[model samples]
Structure formats: structure tokens, C-alpha cells
Target: MPPNLALEIKCRESERQALLSFKQSLVYRYDILSSWTTQAKANDDCCNWIGVGCSNNITGGDYHITRLDLHNTGLMGEIGSSLTQLSHLTYLDLSSNEFDQIFLEDVASLINLNYLNLSYNMLRGPIPQSLGQLSNLEYLNLQFNFLEGEVSEVHFSKLKNLKALDLSDNFLRNCTLGPYFPRWLRTQNFSVLDIAGNMISDKIPRWFWNNLSPNLLFLDVSYNFIKGKIPNLSLKFKTMPVIILGVNEFEGTIPPFLFGAQNLDLSGNKFSDISSLCEVNYSSPLYLLDICGNQIFGHLPRCWNRMLNLASLSLAYNYFSGKIPHSLSNLTRLKSLNLRKNHFSGEFPSWFNFTDLIVLDVVDNNFSGNLPSWIGLRLPNLVRLLLKSNNFHGNLPLSLCNLRRIEVLDISQNYNISGTIPTCIYKFDALTKTLNASEVPDYLKDLVMMWKGKETLIHGRNLQLQRSIDLSCNRLTGEIPNKITELVGLVVLNLSRNELTGQIPYNIGQLQSLDFLDPSRNNLCGENQDRLIVQDLLFAISSGFIIGFWGIFGSLLLFKRWRLAYFKFLRNIIEKPL
Candidate 1:
């Protein structure tokens, strides 16, 4: 067709009316589809409207709408059936909406759809099997939705051109995907497959791997109950894949076939050994390796120097013991290291000088001795330092105050740790100012923290502006440092269950952002005692009251300072001004 002739073509009036009817059914946050109006002459052309794509299939025939992209437009309500009238549509995107599930059946009538995305919506109930009628659909995304019921092979019986499928974060069942090996997928070659966070609870059949698409570049089956060990076979890949099989029940030695992946996560499984890590031939440069919460035990492999490209590594919640291999220092690009809740013993690695390091979590380990004083000097970029529940015994190193960007500092529950709270603690500027969301690293985005004796997972957006310090359940004995109150952005400050004495900081009230402050069980008392919540007050005095209230009060009366404070409190209660 001539260029001038194409410009002269106008969309069929029927399709324009259909789109206008569709808009009547929508409840949008803003008038994003304001161009869909039909009052003006140019606006009457549906093909010229925003997000609508049109093309002339005939030399002189009328143009037809072939695409409708409305994802993330904040449109919600009952999706109108008028969309079924646009039979020429080869591409359609209606994701991230809150529309009702009344149009899926109507959508099946359009056999020309080659790309369909209805993810992150309120579409509920079983997917209509008639959807398979669209044999040209090459990509389908139904993730993060409320769709339910068992999906059989018939649901995709005619989708022979399908190349990518995502049904993650749904309420689908194990049987929804069918037998040990979905033989229905033997013919199609997919590049990306994600079925995570579902009810998948069967061992991956060996035959399934043989049929796996060689073109696959991304696979995520995490957060399921898949069982059995991966057969020891040297599988190959055409691309550097990013595979995630975390939070499953796969046990035994780490398989070598997985080494070909550039980013791999096998955490929260029953795997007992990882010697294969050192034994395998390097197939690709690994960037991220997370095997946390597994049964892998004994000394870490000393061959970490082989993967110098490693940036993020996590072996937390495992049984691994013995000193961390010194070869870890060879990974100069390391940015995050999480060895939390393990039996790994020895002093914290003082030699690691990775300037790009952002997060270091070694909580609940047997690591003992004074924390290496060179931490701040070695890793100046440290943002979250969680060293709680260890045998670390010594004064809180003042050098730690040099971590200027630190947001969360939890050196709590180390029984033998004793010292006056460092006055230089306020140097952590991240704790005093509202940190921009961009300043938080990707590794600390899902960082966890203990708040008020309960474990809480604080996400990055909230954590960026929230600062915390937990030094509870330790033997620290001294007056709480007055400089601590300078951190105006501090949200959670816990110093409970310690033997600290003297008054609380006089400027404690200055922490305007303080939400959960616990100073219970400490001998410290002051006019700012009202800062502690009622629950903490009960926790502080209930134990002594149960043990022997009179005895405890009698002992306090023997001290002149305690006696005067007690009488003053009693007099204030009795001499009511009213």
C-alpha cells in the first residue's frame, strides 16, 4: 500500500464503538484513556487512540485495531465483553488491573491473539479451556492473580506456539500442572518458565530434564515442596541460565549440572553436602550463590578463589562449622555475605577488604573473641551489621562508630559483652537522616530485624528511613550514653535485659521517630521512664514481684539514692494537686 493511502485509511466504526463501550465499564484512578472519547472527529478513529495499534491488511480495505496495551493503568471494575469484537487483535495486555473475571471466556473467541498478558489482576475461577482455541498465542502470563482450580493439559491443548509461560504466585495445586512429567510440554521449547510459590509437591522426573528446552534462559521453581535429589548428570546449556530451586526438599550433594547457571539459588532444602562445588569444572562465571538453610556441614570449600566473580553469597541457617576458608577473601567483588544461624566458629574475618561490601550478617553463630576492630576500616561501605547471638566478648568497639552509613546495628544477646555505650555511636548518619530509597542496596532490601523481642522482616522501602539499635540481653553495665538520643531517625531502640545502671538519656524524648523503645529489666531509672510501653513495664517489675516483691523493695530501700527516689515517687502519687 502507498504511504499516502495508509494515512488516509480509517479504522472500522464498529471497533471504535466497541472501545467506547469498554471504557464505560472501567473505574480508573485517572482519565488515562481520555483519548477513547468519540465526540471529536479525530477522536472517533479508534486506531489513532493511545495504546491502540492498527494496520491495513488490504491495499485499500479499512484499517483494523490489532493491539491494545493497557497494563498498569490503574483501571479496575468489570471488564466489558465489547473487547471480543476486536477480532483482529494479535497482541493484548490487560495486566496489573483489578477487573472482574467475566471476560476470559469472551476472550477465547479471538483466535488471532498472539500475545496475552492478564497477570496481577482480580481474575478468579478456573481458566476457561476454550482459551486454547487461540493457537497463535506465543506468550501467556497469568501470575500474581486470584485464578484457581486444577489446570489440565486441555487448558493449553491447542497452544502449540506458546514459548513462555508464567503462573507463579497463584493458588494453583500440584495436580494443576499434571503428572510427574508434563508430557504435554515435550514438543514446545520455552525460553522462560516460572511456576514458583504454588502447591507443586512432587519430585522432578528425570525424563523432564531430557525434554527441557535447550533455549531456556530462566527457570524458577522455588518455594514449593519438590522432593528427591537431582540425578548426577552433566547436563549442558546453551545460555548462562538464572535458575532458582530454593525452599524445596532436594537432598544430597550439589549437582554439577547446576554449575552452568550464572545465578543459582538452592536454599532452604535438605541438601547435605556441597563438595561438588570444588570438584566441578567451571561452566560459567557465577555471580550469585545462595545455599542457605540447608544441611550442608563441615568446613566451607577452600576453592572460592575459582569463582572470583561472586558478588552475593549466603550460607545462613546451615550446619556448616569450622573457620571460614581464607580463600573467600579472593572474591574482591563480594557485596553481601550472610552466614547467620550457623555453627561456624572463629573470629570475624578481619582480612576481608572488599570495598564494595554492603551487608554482613553473621548472627546466631559460635564466633567468639573481640570483634575485629578493623571492620569499619576494612569495609567502609557496610550498611547492616547483625552480630547478635554469638559468643563475642569485649567492649563495643568504638571503631564500629565509623560505619557512617549503617542503618541497623544489632550486637545484642552476646552474654559476656560489657562496656559503656560508645558516645560516638551518633556518627552513623544513616540513623539520623531519612535515607533515600535509592541508597539502599538490593541485598538489604529484604533485611530482617528483631523488634521488641519479636523477629520482624522489614522491607527496604521502610528500612531506608528507619534506624535501629539492639543491645539487649547482654552484660553491658553503665549509664546509657546521652549521645544516643541524637539519632532523630531512630525507630527501634532496644536496650532491655541488661545490668545497666543510672538515668536514661536526658534527651531521650528528642528521638521523634522512636516507635518501639524498650529499657526494661535494667537497673536504670529516670524521669523519662514513661518512654517504655506498658508491656515493658509489666515485664520489668513482674519477675521481681513474683520472686519476692517486698524483699526486692526492702533491698532498694537500703540504698540512700533508691530510698529517696522511692519516697519522691510515693509522695507525688499521694500529694495530688487536684
Candidate 2:
């Protein structure tokens, strides 16, 4: 080999030794880099190490390290300064690690980096402003970190080529005087941007939305303290595909243009009305819409049939009244629907054919009339049905047993509803067996239920694959069905405050997974009552015998002549009762 080629090989070996030193400083539980241990034997090259890659130098130069991906490798250590040795690195990922107190100054030296991810780490302290020096960066993710302090313009001003940026779930707060919108982002072009779960408290500036880059497609600012109303959006620019402004303090009517977004989330606010959204000409590819936990009132408008792409719709915890618009049946793609905690009255709307419905919650409403038996026939995929605290009356339709996938069923607090619970309740297959972990969906319906005598808020994975049956606070009469004991996977059972007669099922103990059980304030009696009577009788007999024997014995001991007469009387009583 040429003398210059030999010198290049020696230099590359030195850089590899530096990287091995950096790994030694970490606390790795798994042997993800078993090849890293072969360096001492000179049998392995640095480029062949796990999570390491080398670049092909076509210019007759030595190959340099270009990529280092150690994501979810169970590494626990400080991001040591030794990483600066890999000057030619273009991609670096150390996400889902336990690296604390990172030295961003060391990372800033990698000027050729194009993508960097440090998410899901124990990083603390301020994001170094030296990161702005990486002009070639295209993607940067720092989510799920303990990073604190402000993020000034100096941290990203030079990164004009950045396409995606996420800084969510951090303790970083904006120290601005007015609006939380960062002024530095006005000039940069970004396709995806997320700053959720931060301490940003201010009104969104009017210019922020109007001046958004035409390439902008997704924006998330949820879970902040942002206040004030959103200005009328201009349609002159390209329409955004996704926008999330949920869990904020913004109050006022929702903008009509928001309905045009494919995925829009405006839940947990004080918006009063959304009728304008229906009045507008919505022609975008709408998918998911969430406006729950608001004070929205008025009947749902009838102009929603055109959006055929809708899947999940949530308008719960609002004041919407009157019947549901029948035109909603046209959207055949609907999957999940929530209208709970409203003032909607009159008979339940049985017009819509929800063939793909999975969750239906209409709790805490003034809905009256008998529950239609067509629920199972119309919605075969139903899993959770919550209709409690309503005025519905009449016997539970036996056809409800046709819902084989039902997991949660609550129809309690209907004062006029009467009759025995159906014996075919065990047919609910979802509640018959213990739900496997894989059967639980990632996102389930959210409902506020009276569980275990307390109001419980359940949703998402917490409510997934859980079985419960609530039929309390009603005027129903008849025996508690013995078939209910067959539901070995039942999680909660409530039958309190009812006029039902007959004993609780003898096999109630068969529900091994039953965590909560309430059968109080009912006219039911069973072995429990018999046990109480037997205990009382035994106590009475023992007390009377103890008192009478002690009274006679004390008298005999006090008087000598009486003692002799008592013995004679006992002998005479044994012979004859008089």
C-alpha cells in the first residue's frame, strides 16, 4: 500500500477507538452491541459495529462514519463529549435512552448532520443555542424530555432547511410578553411542527396563521394555556391537513374554516356554538373531529352529510339539544360517536344505520322513551353502550343479547324502567372471558361513570378490554338472573337502589375477576339474611343461660341454708318440672 493510504488507515482506527471509549462510559443493560466487544481482538472494524455506518468516499479518500442509530438500546449515561470525534456524521439517533444533562455544545460540532433525534431521554437544562449552527439539519426531535427554560431564536435561526420540528412534552416555557407564537418561525418554512404540552400562555397572533408557509401541512399547539379567539382564517394559502388546538383556554365561536381540515381537534375549551361550521361550504377531506368538553349549544346542523370521510366524531359534554340530524346517516364511514352529557330529549334517534359503530355514549341526558331493540341489528360492531341517567322506561329488550362484542353496558338511573334483567346476558362474549392484552384497542371511548360509588373518568387504554354492567337506581323488579355469574371476566357489577326481589345468585363468587360489586338498597334477600338470623338466635340463647345460672349461684353462696335448699330443689326439679 502507498504511504498516504497507510496513514489514512491509522487515522480511521484512532477515530474508532474514540467511539468505543464513549460506549464504555454508558450503562447498557442489553448486549445490543456485542460486536463492540470484538474491537480489542482486532477482529472487527468500527463500521461493522451495531448501530454504526460508514460512508463511501468516491473521491479517493478514506471512508468516514456517517450514521449512528442507538434508539431504544437501553442506554443509561450522559451524552459524553467523545461524540465530537465523529465529525462527518450526517445522521444520529439516541432516542428512548436515559441520557441526562446532555452537552448540546458537543453535538453542535457535527455541522454535517441532517437528522437528529434525542427524544424520550432524561435530558435536563436549557437547549443550547449552539444548535443553530447546524445549517444542514432537516429534522430535529426533542420530545419527551425534561428540558427546561426558554427556546430563543438563536436556537434555530440558521436552520432554514428544517422540514419537521417537535419539542412537545417538555418543561420549556416561552418568556414572551404577549402572544405565545414565536417570531422567529415566521421566516422559516416547516411542513410539520408540534409544540404541545408547554407553558405557552398568550393569544395566537393574527399573522401567524395567515403567514404560514404554503408547505405547512401539520401543526399542533394543544395542552397549553393559550387564550383569546382565533381570527377568521384566510383561504388564500394552501389548506392545512391537520390542526390541533385542544385543551386550551380559547373561548368564542369556532372558525368555519377549521371544519375543512382533515383532522381537527378543538376539544376542552369554552366555545359556545359550532353552527357556523355547518353553514360554511366544507369541501375538504375531513376525517376525525373532536369538540368535546365545551359549552356548545343549539341543535346539530343538517349540512354534515357531504363530508363522507368522517370516522370518529366527539361532541360530548356540550349543551346540544333536540334530535340528531337524520342526514348524518349518509356518512357510512362513521365508527365512533359520542354525544354524552347533553340536554338532548325525545325518543332516541333510530334513523341512522351505524353499521361500523364501536362506541356509543349518550349518558346524563334527558332522553326518554323505550330503548329500541334495533341497536344490535343496526350496530353489530358495538363494544360500549352508555345510556344511563336518562328517562327511558320499559323492559330491557332481549334482542340486546345479540350484541356479542359488548364490553360495557350501563342503563341505570331510569326510574320508570321495570322488569327482570334478561337471562341471556351471558351471551355477551366480550365479558365472558378474560380480555387478552392484545385485544385492547389503543384508543377506547371515554365516559364518566358512577364506578364503586365514585365518579370515574375512563377512556383510552384504561377502558380498553374492560367489562362492566350497571343497572342500579331503577324501579326494575324480578329475580337477579343466575346467568350473570357466568361472566367470569366481569370487572364491575352494580344493582343498588332498585325494587328488585329474590336473592342474589348463589354463584356470584364465581366472578373471579370482579373487582367491584354493589347490591345494596334492594328488596333482595338470600343466604345472607339467613346467616344473620342464625347468628342472632345463638347470641340470645347463650346470654339468657349465662345470666340465669349466675343469679342462682350468687344467691346460694350468700346463704348457707339457701345453698342446701337449692341442692334439694335441683334434685326435685330433675325428677319433675313444677
Best by lDDT: 1
TM-score for each predicted model, relative to the true structure: 0.82, 0.82
What clash pairs does model 1 have?
none
User: Per-residue alpha-carbon lDDT of model 2 for 140-245, expressed as tens digits?
Assistant: 9987776766687778889988888987655443332123657667756777888765546877777777766655688888766788888767552265468888
On the 0 to 100 scale, the lDDT of residue 577 in model 2 is: 43
Q: How many backbone clashes does candidate 1 have?
A: 0
| Candidate 2 clashing pairs, residues 3+ apart or interchain | none
Q: List per-prediction Cα lDDT, in the order shown.
A: 0.76, 0.75
lDDT of 1 by residue, 51-90 (tens): 8999877877667999999999998898768999999999
lDDT of 1 at 512: 34
